[model samples]
Target: MPFTGQLEDGRPFIATLALQAHGTGVVGDGKQLKFWIDPWLSTEPLKYKFPSLFCLEQDKRCNVADRIPDCNGSHAVCWNWKHYPATEMEIEELIQCHRLLSNVSLSKQVDRWVWRQEDGDGYSVKDARNWIKGEVLSVNNSVYQWCKWIPNKCNIFMWRASLNRIPTKDALLHRNIYVENGLCGLCGEVEESVDHLFSGCRFASGMWDAIASWCNIPRFYVFSLSDVLLVLNDLPYTAKKKDIMYGIIIIACWRIWKARNDKIFNGSVSSVTLLVADVKSLAFLWFKCRHKEGCIDWRNWCNFVLPVM
Candidate 1:
């Protein structure tokens, strides 16, 4: 028989207990903890919170004391940021982190680790168990938005495509893998990055335009994967219709990828009309199988008029 008690497994049980029982508490003396690796302010280490800044740092293992400035015999603390932010998002995050840390005052007391998840700042097995339970139940629900109306494999493909993890020519080049050329297979113009292959290329842009017109949506342009994902968010349609539209967009992306591969490997090119028809057919099949409440037919699907909810 299998174990079924609260402390059922030994390895995971001890690991969870250890994680909840220890948290670094910073007293701002800057001597005992690292600036990047220690969990001083937030639950996560500063390295994760400020990844861009951490990457540009010359010294990866520098401690907090090394970055703090001594202000003329006073207890005031100042950050000596060694590197500048590289992008707009990085600049905003860096400013926020600087403002948060600059407010801290250095003390003579040494920094120490404490059990922050428990009451009275002490460790308890019961507290650790409860903390683990809470964390397990808290999911990043936004992930479901990517996989909602598509098949499992297509959803996984979309997720990887969004992250630029697909083995496209440009992605291979970025990983130091040598390729003959980086031009897009579909358009044969410009380097085939994730954004360019999906939206920036003329071929892909034309497909998006056809899709928008078919769905009766206004003529909108897609510049990146983020734009594709967020295009249906604020549309003027019912929730069910929006779900169908989302499915169509996902199918269109898959079809574009398929057509690109077919052209490269099989020396065959599909026209825009045929590609749009494939998207409509596949989307109709998926929506019909997945959404049972909506009574839809082939004519309504082809015309993009979803039945009343």
Candidate 2:
């Protein structure tokens, strides 16, 4: 039986452990498995993979056992698709799923969960721990590449901005929040989206140009926030230089966001000159405080020579 809160104060931990264990677990039989919720074939749950079909399902809690209908003479298993497709896309998806599952043959064996992480296909605490550790490292490497060097606040801002999670006008609108207008505050011609607010706006484009010139880097295109976050990776620079560039990029994003908020809340305006100056100042302060390898003066920072020395 599942542990209740009254019975187990540590139920949450057990739940988390089940989630972690489920990542490496695969289905051996169709019985005792919810058709929609179980991760039988793919890493994603079936409900997520086939949302339209799942929505049309009469029994949302129906298991795989209920879907497999017995054949007349042959001992073959067949799927009973009880739900109808609502759209052409859903129809195509259903056909695809049907083709994929057509080859899966069921046996009289009992339902069992097998761990894919272990060599013997058995669950082990060590294997689960290693799998969870690897998952954490993979997520951290992709999302927090520059978090260790930059300030937490700045890193978080950049992270959210890059993922387009900030409550921008467009984002709010998408979430069913009504706004008077969606035009960018800096450049009123374009929509105030994450890409436009940071990279596509004329004002933002000018700021990028100024930053590039100040950093002594050649002209480069920044079509989106992803370009800014991943610019250092594509550049042919030393690791130290790349680290400094990463911090500067984060500072620029944070300052741009601040300028946007100021315009929205305080009716203040930001110029390219002011934005570049702030980036330079903030980058210098952050690098000086957080980094201690080399001494960086104001002049070197302004001229973008701090990377060399």
Candidate 3:
């Protein structure tokens, strides 16, 4: 019924009759005698909506913009559109689509992922596509696409370091020597647990002494890295500074590992001076490589690192 019709006219039905009939509209304004008939478009439920394809998308259908010219100004684009019904989630998807079309594009730093339990693999695909196209969050992975905005109460560098179930290198070291002996290597007065090896050992004490001035850390010993960070988190320093300190702790632990290996395998001895020198040099390199672009620079840590803690 629509073909050879008055298609170009925005009101397609009116033009169709004109084209199919006598090449003139039913109601002629110029002629004194004329006839008019209200077209029977109401026979279908879709009459009100499909004035054009663009209008269909505007009404929350899935048509794209490029197809507007293809429809050729047709009114049947809605095609039996009886106010299509959608589930709540479908409604949400429509809202998201509308946002993507109507607003100015978003910034890259902002991203979001839907935390819906019902979402399947399709959710991840959609999440990635939306993110690559513009600013959107990937909540599927539970990672912060925008971590820089969050206010950190403490430097979580230690926390960020993944904890594994592997046996401690120190325990492995001692176990290689004595399978059941829990004797200490420092004062020989306590068991060689993590606390005893790193904190109470004569060798470990010597290592701490060298970095004590540069680290300005307190003279207390904790059993684990978690304990160290737990105490450090409460320091009255800025979050940025705390992150730097956390970096220092990680580097120090790494050096401690090296020193332990040196003592155990190479039969080489370590000194506090040597360890301190290693910590400062490595800390400087770390800050230069990681934070060179920031307003805070390496020299600022001098007083803080040099403090006798």
Candidate 4:
């Protein structure tokens, strides 16, 4: 989280986004924790999971203890809804809410917060820093090195493309969206799947060939998007050169996607020479501006020469 605002007494204030995300409150008395806002019952707060119910809830600031009433010896869950649940979805959410509360058992001990990310109840600055930096391992088990030199939009696009999450023609078709033709917008040879668009398509292949020649690297005959991303890893180059190549590759991919969109939406023609030139100039601009050690001359950059580190 960003340390932005100052306190009332003029001290710097640290944002609690990390705290609220990783902090899991253990309900004991439940009086101190807000039922809808606090993540006591699950990893996510009920407000996010049950938005319909939260919206209908009359007492927005009601605590867990306020929502759950004591019935003689046992505790019964109660909701202070402004209006009764009318929609089927809302009714289902209400039922699920009750089911979530049915297994919860309150204790006499005071409610406490625990860091859900780590093993112990205590929070660690190292862990928080890692979480903030997005250093945590991916759920898909794919190790993607986020290029710091490139723009975040490029990195994000590459990440999504790596995960096959981008809305390619084939992806749109799979999602039941109507498409006159599912062939690649760039080449129109085969179906526009993630792999084909970024790697297998004739347009993408030419782009990669030109880039490889320009970068003084071996031709990357990739079959999938993963191959395109991991090609730099196998290259016999220094870490710094690999970093530069990775950023260039990401920019190329971003430009390819933009070209495809322009073709489909704006009737723009895709050109290999123009596209490669755009990639080279953009990669040069973004790298020189964003990277700390980016003092390479434009002439050397045009010739793909890396200054000795």
Q: What is the C-alpha lDDT of each candidate?
A: 0.69, 0.68, 0.41, 0.80
Q: Model 3, stretches more than 4 Å misplaced?
A: 1-190, 205-212, 216-218, 221-223, 292-301, 304-309
lDDT of prediction 4: 0.80
Q: What order do candidates take by lDDT, descending?
A: 4, 1, 2, 3
Q: Name the runs in model 2 displaced over 4 angstroms.
A: 1-144, 307-309
Best by TM-score: 4
TM-scores, each model vs. reference: 0.53, 0.53, 0.39, 0.55
Q: Per-residue alpha-carbon lDDT of model 3 for 92-157, expressed as tens digits? A: 544543443342222222122122323344335455344433321221233311123112311232
Segments in model 1 whose C-alpha atoms lie over 4 Å from true places? 1-144
Residues 1-309 of candidate 4 have per-residue lDDT tens digits of: 343544222333232445557888888877767788778888889988988887677655577888875555365877777689989999999899888888776767787777885546567888777765552233236766799999999999998988778989887977899998988898886778888888767788889999999989877667579889888877789998888998999999999999999999999997989999999999889878889888888999999876743
Q: Which candidate is the best by lDDT?
A: 4
Going through the candidates in the order shown, the clash numbers are: 0, 0, 15, 0
2 against 4, candidate with superior TM-score = 4
Worst 10 residues of 2 by lDDT: 2-11
The TM-score measured for candidate 2 stands at 0.53
* Lowest summed lDDT window (length 10), candidate 3: 28-37
Residue 138 local lDDT, model 3: 23
